[model samples]
Target: MIQKAQEFMNENHFADVSRVQCLLRKMMSKEYHGLIDQIKEYQDPHAIFNIHGGNNLIAPTASQAEQKLVEKPADEIKKDKE
Candidate 1:
């Protein structure tokens, strides 16, 4: 779950950016959709880079996506837009 992942990262001193990679691997797994159903609660679901929304999971809405974009470095944001 997301909390477990955060705990792993904290215990290992991993940066926040690493969460994106960590969740991406989990999201890509064969059990991803099933896992969504089991995840009754979660936080920052948008942090998963390429989410596949099952019946339970919800992908970032447009405004949320834009907010994430604003958090990036200016140059990176420009490159993304390009």
Candidate 2:
């Protein structure tokens, strides 16, 4: 069933994320706890995001960016406030 869902996602290039999430929720609800775990193992977030078509780019390092932001001088902050 998960494989079929994945194939459907691939075939429908413009599928809606909310709809797919809803369908997955319904499937999960009808199953027992053990089956739910198996379903979760099969439902890969990266694969789903890729199917929905994301920017395949790696994101900038957040810690580095935050460090740079925090390291800004008081003078620089005041200048920007002008």
Candidate 3:
């Protein structure tokens, strides 16, 4: 799954500093105790921002989120901005 996620990330045009734990949870295969450390080590505050939600974050390199976003309907895109 991590390999798949990395592939997904690579296609989106994000960066290494953006793969936060929140994003990882979306693809989680098991519980992670090191989530916080992972987020701080990755997520890009400038591009993705809001790495402080409780899940405590998100960021990426081509990111799975962006890859999913690429598949989103036009209306969904509008909703994300709002």
The digit string of per-residue lDDT tens for model 1 on 1-82 reads 5445533443443355444455645676664544333222222333443345433244444334334333555356446645
Model 2 lDDT tens row, 1-82: 5445655654565686457656776765544323223322223323322211343333433334221224455356446645
Residue 71, candidate 3: Cα error in Å is 33
- In model 1, state the lDDT of residue 30: 64
Error of 1 at 79 (Å): 23
C-alpha RMSD of each candidate structure in angstroms: 10.4, 16.0, 13.5
lDDT of 3 at 37: 31
User: Ranking by lDDT, best first?
Assistant: 2, 1, 3
TM-score, per-candidate, Cα-based: 0.25, 0.32, 0.26
Q: Local error of candidate 3 at 6, Å?
A: 0.4
In the predicted model 1, the residue pairs found to clash are none
